[model samples]
Target chain A: MDLVERIRSGNKRTLSKLITEVEYDTETGREALRELYKYTGNAHVVGITGSPGVGKSTLVARIVKELRKREISVGVVAVDPSSPFTGGAILGDRIRMQELACDPEVFIRSVSSSAGTVGRTTKNIIRVLDAAGKDVIVIETIGAGQVDLDVLNVADTKVIVLMPESGDEIQMIKAGLLEIGDVYVINKADLENAARTKSQLSLAIKERDGWIPEIVMTIATSGEGVEKLVDAIFAHKKHLEDSSNLRKGRLEAVKSEVVEILVEKLKMRFYEKFSNARYSDIFEQVLDKELDPFTAAELIEKEEGL
Target chain B: MKKGKNIRVLIAKPGLDGHDRGAKVLARACRDAGMEVIYTGIRQSPEQIVETALQEDVDVIGLSILSGAHMSIIPRILELLNESGIGDIPVIVGGIIPPDDVEELKRRGVKAIFGPGSSVNEIVEFIKSIT
Candidate 1:
């Protein structure tokens, strides 16, 4: 059977192989993804982002458990940083999720942040899992920074997890993180100033599209308040459902995905075309200031008739 | 065979061994060598290790055990991998296996074994050569 059919038939091994194909960006992977694209849009993608050591993975593990209790099948994509120098990643998020391993209802894949994004290929990975028949897919970003809001484009529910007494609440308000989160979680609530952090978040969070973001406290290690966090996620999902926001968001995501693919292809093509020794004269021209970068680029474009 | 393909390896600690320092160092070394290493942390069961390897579709599986349980745990891991139909993914064992057991492990389908005093370069070179 073909990969798409095998994935549809719930063959875990085939599903995994396809994911690897897609992760590695192979042509076969692209073909399989195109075939499986029609089967997507069924899974609810929940993106969890936070700084390192904020219990994002622990919270994700708890959320997956809560989801399973409700009879929902889950797929988790846990992203960890690849070394800038070595292009290697530890991907230790599964360490906190050992209990979920034996559960056939859950499928977890660890991804390396290879292309510099928090969750590179995350949108495509979500589609693969969605096609494989997961009910909900969770994307755990690699300890996001203020501007690492790529999750905003893929996740239906954007959850920004933070810890108490970390003073990140103030930092979040000034950045794109505040604008993207559909739900806010102050995990490690047992730490001091939990209420203060929550109140700070509440005060800064404004209503968007008639849906007010909810801040739920969670102690993810003990699974405390995770159920409430899951409820908040569902509530946000429902809010998107009752409104036209879900369709609109999906449309926007689709547009962004297409544009990103186009840009990436153009970049690769540009490098491939210009890296040859034949382009040395063009480089010399630029180095000698015979032409400005913009005009030189135009010349290259015109020479290629692009 | 794609240009962008990366060798994905699952670095697991089987049984109750908590001495993951070697595993972690090797994971870093693998990454530094431009491979994606999935470290499942310490105290993982054989079932958990197999499941992770399958799900991740890793090209290699590196087992790090210090509890002197490689004899018992490694076989169960191999058995589970075969049952899962991913037995072809090479299994490389590290961490305190005596030289006598090395031959036995290789006979049992362990691709390679790295004991103490083994350089990171040697291990990395071995993985790159194989995968």
Candidate 2:
């Protein structure tokens, strides 16, 4: 409760703890979110993503630092998904942004997509944090050079980062990177083929339709050319809002999320009850093809009414 | 003797290295041991791993780090759990741990380190002993 209150009052420690608890979906976490939900919607959510080696972490840290310089309070959410058999997180991108955790005006949260759903639960809890009162939110998805397009679905503004010459237009097309970028950043600007990479991305962008996403060139590690990237983020966020289509999309998404949460809860409860109950005889009867999945579902729903 | 309740385990793989064959296999083994095992799909963060272990009310946070970044990642997760008051969760380490770092993780409060070639029965037995 103290953490919830303090987070609402913009306390970094409280916000950090609350983010962890809520991301974990603890009872207190849910309650804290419920209390703070009304305070969300104030923070702008900016999602930073791209292929694995595009230096998304370094890029995100730079962006957060830049935003902080503007006196804007920011919350960072980073997702890491490297294998741990070696006994460590492979990406460790969150560590790049770890310094911001100590800042009172900045709250940073790292989520492993492994522990969370395609970020739906993470987003819910984070939206709760934002409502509790942060000025901006940035989410870094796990992995590099994604083909899944999962992060684009999660972000208010999608910044797809690419390392110049990391790959060609064909590679970007193969990874489906061409479609997800609301803003394309050719990072590693200090590299040898920065210009060539930009041209290839330009070709990729031209080949795509609709919004004609902007492409920015950056050298994220040294903080070179990141301000333009942040400006592009804000602009894109504004563009999405001004379009008014975003509101409708958001409403639909919220409704879908609520439906999904309830369905999952009921499904889990049904599974638990079915697994533990003395309905084995009935199940066996059905197993003989006497009852179908629909009837079974109906019976379970009728019996539980949850 | 078996502990007060089932030994809960959270099996997680964090970061971009998405080879999950080992993680899935280990998850199944832990469950077969009669431990309540929660498998966080693939590519998790130290924070997500720590948070899930807390909420799942798990007894052991078994991390399977295949990527080479284990040195930097495992310590941060331990720190987060400690910060959250559940530092006593009796963390376990698994997957390609270099033999040299095995003792180091244990010293950092990791109770056990199970790597490639480790047996499920042995892991179960180890968990039983700890619990």
Candidate 3:
């Protein structure tokens, strides 16, 4: 059978291969996705993101363990940042979730965020998991500060994991995480000042648009309060479904995906047009101080009939 | 396409060995050499190794076995990789393999073996050359 057929039949190997294809943006991967796109939209996509060392990976591993107890088939997309100098990543998230590695019902894949847009690759991988019949798909983003709101566009439920010692509540608010988090978590709650941080987060989360985001405190290492966090996630899922918010979220996701694809296509077209001898000639002219970038761009536009 | 895309390698330790200093060092070396390294932690089963390798879609699988179980574990991994239809992907073994076991491992589809004090640069270069 072909890749699409194998993926639809719940083949983990094919699902993985297709995910790699999409992650690398290969032609075969694109064709596979085009064929399998129609099989998507069934799984609930959840994005778990937070600052580094807040125990995001540990929390996700605990959540996946709890999810399995409820007989949920999960697909985890763990994203790790690539080294800027080396283009290499440690991808240590799977180590935390190693218990789930041998579980047939649980599929975990680690991806490097260096593959262009983390959000786009994440969404595409979620689609592959959905096509493979996972009931819940979790996207764990690179915990690199506050620039990771891209997860907001790819998940049905956006969860931001934070710690009690994550610093001043005002800083969290300023980071704009308060606005995007559908469910907030105070992980490492065993640390001192847990209650104080919870209260501060509670005050910061005031009711928004009729949906109040719940703050759940968790000691991920011991799996403390993970059950309540799971409950909050289910409650949020129910709220989205009951209030028809799911439809709105799906529409936004589709819109963002379209924009991402369009931007990538335009970039590819621009590179294809300029990656020849003409590009080198322009570079040499710029290096010799014979042409400014702006003038060179205008000349190229005119010459290319743009 | 970019000149050289990221080379993904899965550094897995199978069996009950907890000695990961060598594995960690190799992972860092590969990362420094500009390859994505996915460390599977310690004491992983062959099933877990093969499954993780397939899911990660790694270009190379580096097995770190400090115990004297390379004879048993290496073949299991190779068999599983072949069964999974991904045997073409190179499998490199590291850690205490007897010199007598080297030819046998290579014959059983083990690509390369890096023993004690083996150069990390050599491992990186081998991966680059093979993949």
* Candidate 2: stretches off by over 4 Å: A1-4, A82-91, A116-118, A144-152, A206-210, A276-306, B1-131
Predicted candidate 1 versus true structure: per-residue lDDT over A1-306, tens digit per residue? 877788987788998888877877778888998899999999999989888999998899999999999999999998887777667777889989988988998999998777654444677888889998999999898775522476545789999888887776557478567777899999999998899888888888899998999999999989999999999999999999999899998888778778977998898988887787767888888899987889888988898898
Where is model 2 chain A poorest over a 10-residue stretch in terms of lDDT? A82-91
RMSD of 2: 9.3
Tell me chain A's TM-score in each of the predictions. 0.93, 0.82, 0.88
DockQ for every model comes to 0.71, 0.05, 0.67
Query: Candidate 3 residues A3-97, lDDT tens each?
Result: 87788887877787788778777888888889888999989888898888899899999999999999999999998888777788899899998
TM-score of chain B of each: 0.95, 0.89, 0.96
> What's the TM-score of candidate 2 when only chain A is evaluated?
0.82
Top of the candidates by DockQ? 1
In candidate 3, residue A161 scores what lDDT? Answer: 92
Which residue pairs in candidate 3 have backbone atoms (N, alpha carbon, C) closer than 3 angstroms, thus clashing?
none
State the TM-score for model 3: 0.91
**TM value for model 2:** 0.64
When candidate 1 is compared with the true two-chain complex, its DockQ is: 0.71
